[model samples]
Target: MNNQQFQTPIEYLKGVGLSRADVLKKELQIYNFEDLLKHFPYKYIDRTRFYKVREIQPDMPYVQVLARLTQKEIIGEKRTKRLIAQAHDDTGTIELVWFQGIKWVEKMLVPGKVYVLFGKPGFFNNKAQMAHPEMELYIPGAQQKGNLTLQPAYNSTEKLKQFTLDSKGLQKLIAGLLEQTAKDIHENLPDYIRNRYKLAGRQESYRNIHFPNDANQLNEARYRLKFEELFFLQLKLLRNKLLRTQKFKGNIFESVGDYFNEFYHHKLPFALTNSQKRVLKEIRLDTQRGVQMNRLLQGDVGSGKTVVALMSMLIAIDNGFQTCIMAPTEILANQHYQTIKSLVGEGFIEVALLTGSVPNKARKVIHQKLEDGTLNILIGTHALIEDKVQYKNLGLVVIDEQHRFGVEQRAKLWRKNIIPPHILVMTATPIPRTLAMTMYGDLDISVIDELPAGRKPIQTVHFYEAQRLRMFGFMKDEIAKGRQIYVVYPLIKESEKLDLKNLMDGTEIMSREFPLPKYRISIVHGKLKPAEKEFEMQRFVKGETQIMVATTVIEVGVNIPNASVMIVENAERFGLSQLHQLRGRVGRGAEQSFCILMSNEKLSHDGRIRLNTMVKTNNGFEIAEIDMQLRGPGNIEGTQQSGVLDLKVADLTTDQEILQQARNLVIEIFEKDPQLAAPENQILNLAFQAKNAGLSWDKIS
Candidate 1:
């Protein structure tokens, strides 16, 4: 036994030489001995019992038997080939075809060898056929029905197969590794913990996942491992949270009296919603606290998040300090500016906007004002954090659409002050709890659940494009009633190809569809330069264009309350959350708003779910939940997104209890041994370090 780490994978183990090892590594990401033990099956075929051919039908997805390969042949070109074969039992003979596997069948076939065959029986050419069924060579008296029980189907890759690392090659290598290392499995969990949870030792858990003799064993293995993964994940989050809270000191500004009076007395164009008022109180309390305030302000679209943010900024300014708001896009930054400039009045506050496009001189002035404390509040995109734009007495940091920026970028804002600024982050994206825990566990959360008075909920409808004429007619009628319309399209062109067709196609179709010049129409998409896109978006926002036909690029977010209708040309292409966010653009005003999802007739189940979800409700949280459920567990871990969860085995959808159990356990552990240094928790600290180093499976379960 060796203590060295083998992160390479299963196929590259000592006994697994270049030939067979090549296959496993390529077909699977197995380059070390341990990977084989953990390479669980994607699915299982219960071959413990065999079925009679007479018992099989078109409806039966599973069938088993002893059969002989009577014949095998290949057809089609090299790129598109098919393997035709025949299998027979006493009841009857059936065709077994494997598309694109002709060569394997040809090499492995023998004239009269009885073997085990398993696959679905289906009708092709009005006869029975089993395409690309799993096959194993017959052994004398091999259970008679051979492979009659649960069978494992390991996932593989083409690169491994290229090295002749077929399924059998993988099975053999795994067997070799198991024989060598199976007995060496160590129990890292304490006895008391295992007994409390009724879990098996670590060794049994690993083996059961690989070669479980029965379903019960597999269940036990899954539970223990998943628990370990989730528990560690939650534990890591708690540790990070404790470290942050204990070490960081917030810029506490108490008695928000001056700020509140200045805004509430003579300013504040509209009365704040109760929810907004509540959130502001929370923010005020948070900023008054000693530790740095890492709070998330969650609200639905037009839920007064910005106003609440502004009031908090007022608190910082009233305390004779400055704050900065960072948005992901220029349009959103400018939109915030427009709202503040419109509502906050001119002289009471000195506000400036900084973006990448600001002129050199203008930027220099803004930077100087910021450094000298002349600037009270600044709103802009990433330009707010550029090396030159230093802050004076920076007390609060407000990040809008916080998800758009990375943790590193946000941290930079916090670090601008001697003590990290009291952080108040805002998001229009109503993320679900499962996702929130994984992403926002490091911060305190405050949600603004109420909408302002006169705010209207968007009326959503799902329909196929075949009903386009009727939908357009309805839009026309709405437009005729002194309202505007947005017809959004999907982008089919890359940045390289000039999508004249996208602009021309949408413009022409929309113009002709709605009686052209009778209704003013404009087009917008990503292909347009920032200036041009802004021009078209401005036109639509101002109601200068009665109908706007554009691509999903308009999803770049131009908030238009006057536009009462949103018609996504091919809604099926959008995720449920995206569709919901698009819908959020409208329904911000007092007027009734409508979202017409005009998707193509051919919609995938997920696509239909997306549209149906939109039709079901305007709740962004509900839509985000649906999206997470549909996307499954492993997928949400993209470059910036997936890292948020950082879970390995425990699934957010299925293992929520385990997540809670981990959280509760950590709380208990911390209560007793805050430093994780007690004898019972000593090994745990080491194990936690090992696990965290191996996989960042902590912080997000």
Candidate 2:
């Protein structure tokens, strides 16, 4: 259809008035004709098949039968009232009942009249019946003439149903729309793409998607639509990357100076793994290229990403530029500050920490040093992005746990320098390949898959509640060995619905079991104030407390090398990624480390799979892949807000092949027509613009 016609509001449609249009928009977000057209069916039923009354089985999904009503009855009083009718065919009779709309159903049911019935069959009192079955008057020799194999089913809500806009009503509106505008639908993909993919015309695809004549046509229609969706998504991401590389000039760090060399040769704590070396090379190459580097660094917990980020910062400093690291939380910011400070020593290079809690007196000094270019490296939480915080020559920005920050916050960091600074985003939560490609497709990705040397792998084990005494004994033994332990509970307080073990009750039990002066336990949770939590955390970090009992608040920043045991209570309540992060709290020392997963006996199928997977492997990527399959991409920890996975048809887990093909095709298209200025490619450019008009990120580098 022409652009104006497709954008026409639904209230102008034949069957939809103002009230119905409002419901459509509120319920399904269908504002215009194009949106209604793109609303594909969730499932379909075979319309050609008709079943005998006797053939109606309780196990049948949905059956259609031609029958006549012989008797009608209304039973029960108000609210619980129901309308029942006996429908009979040549073989036998079955009852049809409606608990809702009883008065209307009684008027619609006519005795001794043939009707078409379709619904799921169930057994009640040893007899087959259908509840709230769809019914229509049947006429002999009046069926539509075509290869009608399937009838589409659309999703509807109770609010829409009240306005008679359920699946059947939506089907009628869509049918009317197609009859008027099917031929007017315009082709969006270029001729070359259509020819390469052997795709059907856009009009035919939309037609078959809603009302398919055969299975082959429906399959082809689905593929064409899925391909188009993925193709455009890739095109947008690749175009953004191209624009950034071409338009933005980055500060070049030409050489590695004395700071890098000194840290590498004399002051380094451990030998760098090959994977770490490889990632450093990648970052080094990007910084020297003179193109603004937007890169994502993915690694498992305790994978030494902080060291690589520090080394990259050193390169920026070598080139006479300032650098900063932005973290999501104050605790994590302090952790990074302490680690970097100890590694760099007191006199080698100047480093400072800025957070919300910094006093005004200290803040003035930091702001002065930053403006004068004396602060070589500054690390802080979101305070780094405040309006007053200015840098002399901010060249490299390393964002820790980048996903926790929003796009606008990162953009603020970019605007701090005259030219956008080189960005290195670090995340310990490993993302699956498909997710990384789609969500952060504009950024180059480098993964550190290997752990550092001399660090032993954490041994993981699962235990049922019946083994509580045994698990407690193991904890006691570990504590007696001068190793600290973390006992993580899922909830801070008791949840009546979840029946999970809370920190309060668990702490009480622990105090009773281990008792008084022999053991000390520190407690922290989300409800605690920052200062209060820090106080408890410090007790554990200093080894004054042998056990730290807390919630998932300890999932990220607290790093105590002496802690050798992680006990997760009610482990089934946590996702795999959270469990993995909690497990990473231990195993930092030279001694052996253990992660004990404690759950009840009756674990759900998904919960069992999650716990079993944790017990099976330590590979973060493997766990992420399984988690994506189980929870899907939308529910993954940091991906829900990306909007890239707001896909209608393409499944990230199953449609990897299609996504890859679309990306490759995007590359080829750009190579041939970089600006999409060619006449044949104008349609593609226009479609892209129409789809992403006001989204600033789509156009910005």
Candidate 3:
């Protein structure tokens, strides 16, 4: 029952020689017995029923038919050639066709022989047919030889089938493997967890997962395996969090002092939402605890996340420790600089901006102030992490859109000070709880789920190309009310040429409709220079231009309260999160803003669902959950880069409860055994260490 037995190479397994092993390794990544064991079935089939030919229906799913093979012949020629065999039962006849491996199939066919035929039933040319059906010689009382509750079906490629490594072949190999190793499956979970959750034993789970005795047993096996997968993942993340707090020291912001007090009382733009207040309190507690604070702040666009970040930075400054905020782009970084400057008012606290485009002379002065004690706050893009940009006791770093920056880039910021700075990463894209538990599990999380008072929700509507004129009229009405408009396109220059063309064409139509002098319109896209894009953005912001046509380049950080209408052309081409962000561009001001989604009359099902979801709700978290369901966890932004979303059985979209249970169990275990030194937990500790052997970033948020 040694664990090393599972590590044996897959080539050494019974029934698999060198050639079949090569195919399995190449096609399925099954290099060892462990990999093969974890390769669970996608589905299962019931093989107890034998259908009569008369009972066969075209709409039926996979069916088994025990009938006599009366005749066989090849139909058509060359590419169209197929081996068709006539299968007859007591009532009627059906056709079994095979277009692939025709010669091999013909060699196996025998006239007047009874066989079990299994495949999907289809009605083509007024006759029942089963294409590429699996055939086996019928034998009476064969069911007595072995147990047949449910048959496992594995995914296989046509390349594997050529070597007879299809689902049936794989099932046979798994059965043999289980016979030898099922009893040797070592238990990793403690007795307490098993008894509390009523989970199946590791050995029983593995055996039933591949070959179950009944439906209840199959369910138990699936639940146990899924729980085990997610349990280990949560254990790694929680242990990382525990180790980080113990190892990394952060500069303590013991005092709130004049800056934070002044901003909260006198200079505040608006009253804080309950959720925002809660998040600030959480940050306060973390910073006061004197431990490195690696917290993720989630809020919807215009939910006032920047305000929260600025307030936290003010606390650091009050404690006589400088702080900085890094953004993903120059525009966003500049935007944060301007917003914080205005919020701080003139001469309150010394703040400077550094970016790639900053003049050398100006950068020198800023660097001097940063090195001295004069600069209280510095904000920039990736430029903040440059070697020359040293801080005089940098205590905190607030990174906007943190995913855009690489881990190494963020790590460099930590190295700026002797004590690693507190990290507060802000993201406007709302992350579902299950995803946050797995992806950002190492970091503490806070969410500003509510928006500020008096801000109206944006009204979203979908329109077809035929209704373009009506949309234009609506835009004109909004412009008449002294509000600006944003028309965003999903344009990619290198790949989506048609989309680029669409942007240009749409701009031309806008120019013709609302010509320059009275109705000023500015055009912008990714291809434009930074200065050019900024100039266009400034024009729209200044109200000099009533309309701005651009790409998704403006999806983030270009905030104008006066811009009340967002017109997204070809809306179906965008994802749910992108569409939500685009809609957020409006509804910033007091006016009842609108988001117009324009697309072709013909729309895909997913496209329709995305549009409908946007129109139905304004809650970013709700939209995020639905988006994860539609696109899966890996495809969502910021998650694919985590490398932790590679799940085998537990789905983030559906197994939220299971994930919560696994996380809770990890928390409980850590509370009782912080070092996992308990005798029953030795296997768990070893497995956890093996799982995270070379990952150095576990200590870094």
Candidate 4:
């Protein structure tokens, strides 16, 4: 349709009045005619066959029957009143009942007339009955005369249904609008794209999606729509990437100077893995390029991401520029500071930690050092972005657990320097390929697929309640060997009270079993004060405690090389990603580590899949793929925070091939015509501009 016509208000549609339009907007977010057209049906039903009255079974799910209305009456009084009608055919009769809107039904029902009834069948007082059946006057030969064999089913709410704007009502309104606007519907994709992919025309797809002639047409319509949705999303992300690369310039690190070399050669703790080396080369290449680098570094937990980040930072220092690392939590910031400080050794390079807990006296010193360009590296939590904090010639920014920080917060760091620093976002959580492409598509991705040498893969096992004693014995043996253990309970927000009770009860049981001075246990949870939590964590870190019992609050930061065991209680309550992260708490030391998943005997289908998947593999990427399939894309750890996966038709879990194809096509288009200056791409330029008209990340400048 023409642009103005497409943007016409929904209230002006054929069947939608002011009241109905309000309901439509509130119920489904339909504001304009284009939105009404794009609201495709989620389900389709075949209406070719009709069941006989006597053949109706109580267990049947929604059946259609052609029968004659014989008699009707009202039952009960006041609020309990309901309309009951009997419909009979050649075989027998069935009862149709409606609890509400009795007046509307009574006026519509005509005795001794044939009607088509559709609803779920159930037994009431040992007789078959249908409640809230959809009724239509029977018309012979209508099916052969262009009536849709496949009927669409739209989603509706009770509030909408009260206004006669239910699924059927929506269908009628859409059909009326399509009859007038079908021919005016515009083709969004260019001719070459439609021909190469054998995609249906936009008009045909929209028509078939709402009312299909048959199953094949319906499938074709769905495929075209899904591909289109994914293609445009990929196009937007890739275009943003292209524009940013062309527009922004970065401070170049021309040499791998003495700082990097010293740390890489003499002060190295262990040999760098081949994967780490390869990723470092990528970062080296990116920093040397003139364009600003926005890259995502994905590595499984304990995969030596920190070393790579530190080396990259050293490159910045070598180029005479300051660097900073922003972490999501104070605990993680402290961990990074201690690790980097020890690795840097004494008096080689100046490093400082700036977190909220840092006192004003020490903070003043850090600020002064940063401004005077004496501090080579600074690491902190969100406090690094404070207005009081300023840096001289900041060239590289390393964000740890980047998803935990909002886009605006990360943008604040860019304002620190006239030239935005090269960004290196590191995450221990492995993201599925499709997700990474959609959510972080604007950023180049580098994956460290292999673990560092000498670190053993954590052996995982599942234990039932009956086997608790055996598991405890195993824990006792590990503790006796001078290794620490973590006992984590599920602390979901909805069940915090019950989970806390479980934690306290489990702790009491452990005290009773191990008992007295021979065993020591430290407890940490979200409810504890920061001082209390830090004190308990330090006891375990220092080996003063044999066990640390807590909730998933320790999922990210706490790192204890001496801890060799992770026992997750009620593991079935946790998602696959969380379970994997909890499992990563161990396997850091030279000794082999074990993760024991404890759940009850009875397990749900999804819960069984989660636990079994954990037992079968320790590959974080594999676990992440399965997690996406099980929980869908939006629910993954950082996806919601990205705000990019607002998908209506594309399912990332099942549509990987489509997503990849779309990304490849977008790259090809950029290669051929970066600005869409080609005459054949005029339609694409218009469509892209129309779809993306607001201020996005790429538009920040």
Candidate 5:
């Protein structure tokens, strides 16, 4: 691939000079010719049809009309002023209006001259009109340009629009670049692979993508581009996984000794589900293979992931090595420590908890034991990665809610061991399969799909504010049965912009309703200090408080078996994944639990879909799929940080088939030529290198 042509500065483009290039770079991150080329259009409009003036209707989406301007007038005054022009064809006359660029429109409008106007039609005063329609001069006896079909619509910012670089302007610039370097565009795929897929040529795809001759050409162009995008992504991810497996050697756990056997046979708390057993087998096989195991363990809340993680940790201990688990928050770290400590029993495993809140004296003793190899397992927050917290023979590292931590922090943990310990990252949020394929494709994934026996699925319901009395009665009934309740608000304090109930105000209302002696209420939110928050949480956990009024901060970490009912105030403000996680907080106990979604009578289309989806199912994966469809992959929590979903064309939600095909092809190619050293595979290597010139692959590996 010739880098010089594509690397040319955007300022040199025919339509964009230095000033416009600066705005393009800042607003859209388009710096060079290659960046501009990769900036694919979001949508397209058909340009082959021209509607007569009489055929235009208010409901028409976007129409093009060939008409001559018969009259022009400036109407209204000040900010409301607009330039209006009457245009007529053989059938009738329609109005065209421009509110902002009145002077420009006035100068462009030449009375009695025919022009082509295109825009969405709107009804004003019972007549059809178009606002800010695009205009082009009409030539007599001129041939239509090769049956032009679709016009690409590039996304532009208001800043770029100031320089006259809207979607159409951008289309013109791309056309110029394509015309100048049509021959310079290089094919990144190998000839054999392209033939197998029956894809269009790279240059041809680009030309048709920006300026297609027909719908068939446009469809072919989109297929080729989407395939190429997904193919390269899968190739990059697979190559990283292959390279890591080949280059890195891991400590081998040859035997499942006393530690693992004792836990399974004698200390086991509950029967392992089939899914759990299968996952355990997979982990055991990975550890015994003597290669670094980078695995992702995905399970919904209350799915018993901790038990699986502990069992895996025991394998490390059985091999005479220590293990450590890192969590994103101190509350979560403390919870894991307490749960694991009790489960392991005294003297079964010397487990220690280390967080910033730990006293200095306790920290000193923990550090000493860690260095002496006495602490068999350590659980902590970011404090675990401190320079002083050294581990002796660290063999396994487990990260809970791994997405919350940054890549550099994870790297810090990887460096603690000489030959990088085997990593097992766990998340309560179930990832959609398509997302897992792209985001965590490098890591082997094992999902605990089935819940443990004797657990009941939480029932979810929705309620409007008018049903507040009924909800209150239900809460009182649960409390009367010795069960606790959680009332979660979305905000800490009242916001002038949002009318939803805040935590403080909600607590006040609950206090007035429940009263003191019989009902005790606790409030927790992000605004409270750490100690204060912990106090309230402990109160709720201890059953001292009948209800806990809180924010989403309690979405994770707080697991109380007695809390059977969770009423989320203004649930419409929360996303599907968040609602699922919050619901997971309940249903921890064998008792039947319920999640009540409270909202106003009015709901937006997306808000209604989200709440409806939550009420329909408790399956985290199903909710995740819907959430991805509703908010795209970028908006999903923690996905934007991964940088893997920087997709230009292929959507993870809709293009699963394409992604799967691309992944299969990647596997076949790597299986045949792992190093891409074969003559036919060289193009794949070059393409990967050119595309990811300065990107970091540490996270992928």
Candidate 6:
């Protein structure tokens, strides 16, 4: 049987053969054809043209010269034979040294033979030298034509180095495979769609990505591929959402602006922001469509999502259907229940809470009530999805902070009823539109782009650990005004073998820094029990735990509006998206809030960018774009599980222009033949099925 192609590495080509193949397969997992094809060049060395040795200088990255090998000598004896060969062009001569085996070095080099060489020029003792530089013995018809063309460099497993199965050898293997792997014909966008969207062809894009042959071709390929990734991804998501909406045929909740009027007239709390009202109106329209509604409602911290959620639930109850909200953690679930339970005529809409911590008897009672349709609305954590818990006529399911729950877990809620309840997933983290479209493909999207009037944007600051005393003083001032603060860290435990600090130590430091009677403090981390966690969170909410030092377990753990300060220790340890989520914990109320990002001096370039981004904007969307740029799309969107299968050749985030073009071509081809049974769409079908099939994203991730 022919080999089953692999993906992501270039070490598996046929000629790589046993020893070298084993290195690639075991060390780097690059054991198949597909792997080599997708292994992108980290950096390219252009050998498109050449320059004389005289033109080369110290520290120049590229040097092309025609030189004669003046001499060849083995400097070191037996165990370490160091082959040193001197080659000179008309301009100057340079030493080429190899420290490993000298047997092949002697044969590869012949004195007084002129050979053209291209390598990084380094200066040593006032002379140019290329240590172990890549060389060619200038055989007629053997050397490449141009002096420099972008040489594709690849990474390989260390073991592969033993058999000389490194980048150069692997590139040799790929050149052969590509020769046999026929140039796929370009799939033209249908004349109409191409003209409409001004997009490129799918086939041409693929060819260009790997073998652009020229710069323009490379650009064309890159643009088409990126576009395809984003477009098809968006298409699949939008299509799934559209199909689900079509299948739902949900019960329409008659538009009751009168309820808003009544609530506003009487027990109303405050005016809703234009964004909140706009999102609510969108939800209202979705729910009134006579089809089940599954929407992801996103807003920044304290942007009134709970209000929108409650209003949507009210629409369901107003239509006589039951609704439930599930939170990832007890603190959050309980908090949500507290805020959502009082939206309507208190006693009019029955509400109940069930969590793992609930007493067995009370739990059974609540379960019975839920099954009997007595509870108008329910809110809880994982306890809500337990097999023992059943909902009577469950019409809507609202999940908060959708990232915390796995895809299957969220999907489980649909099975709670014969007709899957309309699922509305909410997240305080405002994912950018492109990311949201792909990440939350199974649901429709609605963004709350505005905040309520009078709500001040959270003031964000990035500080080093040295500024601890000043930060502590600032916190003390906020606390003096009767507010709270949260100090967060990255790790839960200290590794005895390692020196890096942990939350426990950070907690200890904060304890010492703020010490005793001056401030009350509570420490909550993953190691704590649920009840213990709830207890500490309760105290924090009640203003007992004046300073809460914890780990990122609190990323989605709790929402303390009164907790006006968010201080993240070693902030560089977290991702941009995570930093934003942690920051979202604060600024939940009307009072002004602040987020302090405490990073160290040794922050990575990307980490610095992430920290700088947080310091610049409270806008999650902007942060998401920056996150996408920093972390790439697959990672930024929590799509790592499916990311490999999600792409064929392009990075949806970085190569968006190419993705868009490919998508237009895909659509054009598909429109011409729905089943992709046509000759043109045949390649498209193969690409998709080959990628998506045999792929259990859950397992791989």
Candidate 1 lDDT, tens digit per residue, 1-701?
Answer: 12244344444575566766656655555567656666766766676666655556787766676787788777788777888877787887778878755776779878588877778878777677787787788788554433644556676667666655555555566666667677776666667678888887777787677666678888898899888777676677777777767788777796666756878877887888889888888888887778888788888877888888888898888888898889999878988888887768878788999988889999899988998998998999998887777888899888888767775676668668888888877887777776676667667788888778888778888877578779978987898888888777666453355322354566777777777468788778667888898888788777788988877665634677678898886778767766776787778667999999876777778888888888988777787777789986445422255365645456787777777776787778878887888887777877777666654321111
Best by lDDT: 2
Clashing pairs in 3: none
Candidate 1 deviant stretches above 4 angstroms = 1-3, 8-11, 15-38, 59-62, 66-116, 119-149, 166-168, 183-185, 492-503, 514-517, 633-642, 693-701
Better model by lDDT, 2 or 3?
2
The lDDT of each candidate is 0.75, 0.90, 0.88, 0.89, 0.90, 0.72
As a whole number from 0 to 100, the lDDT of residue 579 in candidate 2 is 95
Clashing pairs in 2: 1-184, 1-185, 1-186
Rank list by lDDT: 2, 5, 4, 3, 1, 6
Candidate 6: RMSD over Cα atoms?
A: 4.3
Query: Residue 428 in model 2: shift from native, Å?
Result: 0.9
Clashing pairs in 4: 1-186
Better of 1 and 3 by lDDT: 3
Model 2 residue 174 lDDT score: 97
Candidate 5 C-alpha lDDT tens digits along 1-701: 34688899999988788999999999999989988988988888877788888887777777888899899999899988989899989998888988998987798889999988888989888888998988877887876542236778899989889998999788888988999988998899998988999999989998988888778998888888889999998888888888788767889999999999998999998899999999999999999888999999999999999999999999999999999999999989989988898788998989999999999999999999999999999999999999999988999999999888888889888788888899999999889999999989899999999999989989999999999999999999999999999898999888999999988889888998899999999988898899999999999989999999989998888889899999999999999999999999898888999999999999999999999999898889999999999999888888888888888878888889989999999999988999889998888888888887887655443
In model 6, what lDDT does residue 300 have? 77
lDDT of 3 by residue, 1-701 (tens): 23788889999999998999999999999988888888889998765578888888878878888889999999899999989889899988898889899999999999999888878899878787899987888778775322245778999999999999999899988988999888778888878888989999999999999888678889999899899899998998888889888888778899889989999999997999999899999999999988999999999999999999999999999999999999998888989999999999998999888999999999999999999979998999899999999888999999888878777898899899999999999999998889888988988999998889999989899998899899989988988889999998776342544433367777878999998787999888898888998898888888889998989988988889899999998999999999998888888888899999998888889999999998899999999999999999989998777677878778899889999999999999999999999998988887777666677843453
Deviation from native of the Cα of residue 541 in model 6, angstroms = 1.7
The candidate 1 region of ten consecutive residues with least summed lDDT is 692-701
* Residue lDDT tens for model 4, 1-701: 34678789999998888998999999899999988888878787666578887888887777888889999999999999999999899998788999999999999999999888887888888777999998888788764432336878898899899988888888888999899788888888999998999999989988989999889898888888888999999888888888888878988899988989898889998999999999999999999998899999999999999999999999999999999999999889998999899899899999999998999999999999999999999999999999999998899999999889988899999889999899999999999999999988888999998988899989999999999999989999998899999999875233645433267788888899887799999999899988899999999999999988899889998889999999999999899999999999899989999999999998999999999999999999999999999999999998886778888778999999989988999899999999998999999998888787675754322
